[model samples]
Target: MRILLIEDDDLIVESLTKALTEQHYVVDVATDGETGWELAEAFVYNLILLDVVLPKLDGFSLCQRLRSQGNQTPILLLTAQDTSTSKVTGLDAGADDYLAKPFDMSEWLARMRALLRRGGASLPPLLEWRNLQLDPSTCEVTCNGQPLHLPPKEYELLELLG
Candidate 1:
């Protein structure tokens, strides 16, 4: 699984990267919201672990921006903002879940599993690039209306690259 972690705290980033990697998740880190936004747009992630307080852009604004642009990826907000208003704002801004700082790792992992099980957001049925079309549901690839059969390794590579 791939996860994007957008956080600025060095200690938190180091700890989470170690923990998530131990679980076999490929994690991409972005310390600021602008970089996070760019990374989110350039690649697909199974989940995004976002800190509510960030440089360049706040998590609430970033979350709202992502939702406004139709990004369906599951977002879990992590922050020190533990108030009811913060939780509500996070959810209302399109975060799938919220976790305050000082949370239990086991609980956090459970939340991650639950959100991933839900499959979060979905991409369009057909993904297009130039004349090439890929159907994720059928695992089929075509170019310029012609079938393009490829080996599984190549197919998986192309899927990831696309």
Candidate 2:
């Protein structure tokens, strides 16, 4: 799965990027809201991780704009603001989920997985076609219990067909 991470904090970006990569997710990063917006408009990502306080554009405005444009990509807000109002505002702005700063990585991952599953035609984590099975989270494929090595495009095609 591909994810767009919009965050200015280098430390947080580094940590999240490493963790997401380790989980077999392809991550595209933007340091500011404007850059993030441009990237999001140009590419297709399974999910977006946006920070509330951003340079040029705030996460709320960005989310609203994307929704206005009919973008249905799942958005998860990552911010330091933990107040009830902030959560409500984020949700109102079209965020699928919200995670406060200093959050547990496990919780973040779980929320992301749920959003991705819910956002994309309700696709399950595992896809199956006859004897073939695909595990999106692990990027693994097996045919009749035998592992199969496939190129990226082939893998994607199989996923689409499945």
Best by lDDT: 2
lDDT by residue (tens digit), candidate 2, 1-162:
889999999999999998987666779999999999899999988899999999999999999999999989999999999999999999999998999999999999999888886865634479888899998855789999999988766876777787
Query: Cα deviation in Å at residue 39, candidate 1?
Result: 0.2
lDDT of 1 at 116: 79
Q: For every model shown, what is its TM-score relative to the native structure?
A: 0.75, 0.82
Whole-model Cα lDDT per candidate? 0.87, 0.89
* lDDT tens digits by residue: candidate 1, 82-148: 9999999999999999999989999998898788768834533577899988765345789999998
Q: All predictions: root-mean-square deviation over Cα?
A: 8.1, 4.0
Q: Candidate 1: minimum summed lDDT over ten consecutive residues — where?
A: 117-126
Give the TM-score comparing model 2 with the true structure, all chains together.
0.82
In candidate 1, list every pair of residues with a backbone clash.
none
The model with the greatest TM-score is: 2
